[model samples]
Target: MNITSFLIYCIIITFTPGPTNIAILSTVHNFGAKKAMEYTYGATIAFGLLLVISTLLNTILMTIIPKILIVMQIIGSFYMFYLAYQIYKMDTSKPTVNQSGTFKSGFLMQFLNPKVVLFTMTVIPSFIMPHYIAMPTVTLSVIAITLIGFLAFITWVLFGTIFKEFLQKHKKAVNVMMALFLAYAAIEIWM
Candidate 1:
């Protein structure tokens, strides 16, 4: 359990710009950072749930039924498309005044995001030595990865929060940015 190596990989994966960050930052610009926290919490929980499910199933099911990977990939892709639609519709100008739904939405979006699943299933597991590592050790390594990922996401959300004012002030620019984000998301799902 080389915690240092795990942390490095986690930082790389979490900090790299992706759908979750795009969604959260846009939400923050529209609704304020406080409201954007909901999405953050949601994403965090979703990540944890995915980690547990994959870890467990990786042992019992994935070994015997390799096709679960394909199912997960398909589900993930569908969810990403749905989220892209959501983002495409987001009116940064008249975003939901009530901040209640942001967290749950963020969490669920992250949970089903195909990109997240792909990275978790393919990239994350490679960092740990499954053959030499015990289950608990592997679990702890994943937990460490989760913690770092969550913190990095929160940081990005905060950056978006701080930039919200600028985004609001430059309405036209913000719209372009949001549109670009939507396009990126669409491409990700499509690919």
Candidate 2:
């Protein structure tokens, strides 16, 4: 694996504005950094697990990915739509109406998110597997990749935290914009 290329790919894909990051941002904006951290923990665990799964089942995934992708696409898109609805109606003034920012939600979101699913499936094969076949090396790579993903998740939370005041000032607009971003993510999965 070309280290630079792999790092670049991981950073771009993980740090990009996708459903998970947007969800984290919305969670931080509405709730707080603590709630967002809870969500981030779940997301990070799921991300690492997905990477491990991809490593263990790389060939099987390659054969079945098209079919799996289709199923995940439908499921993920619907979930995004649901999240969009939740965010749109989110009122920070009211107590937590739903548990969208909970650890469970974050964990499950990774499984249902097509972008995450695809990245986890592809990253191992594309970057780690080719260069290193040793178990230790592969495991380390998985850990490193997972760390990269965790950083990305945390960055979104920090971004929301740093701008929480401004976001809250225009809560309605921010929520609508975040909601629209998620809905757009849902729609983009098909295209």
TM-score of each: 0.79, 0.96
lDDT of 2 by residue, 34-105 (tens): 989999999999999999999999998788889999999999999999999988987656666445588988
Candidate 1 residue-wise lDDT, 58-176, digit = tens: 55654754575566556766665565565556665564666433767877776567667766665335666544468787777678767876897789778987777787787556656
Q: Note the residue pairs that clash in candidate 2.
A: none
Candidate that scores best on lDDT: 2
Clashes of 1: 4
lDDT against the true structure, per candidate, is 0.68, 0.93
Which residue segments of model 2 deviate by more than 4 Å?
92-98
Model 2 residue 156 CA deviation in Å: 0.7
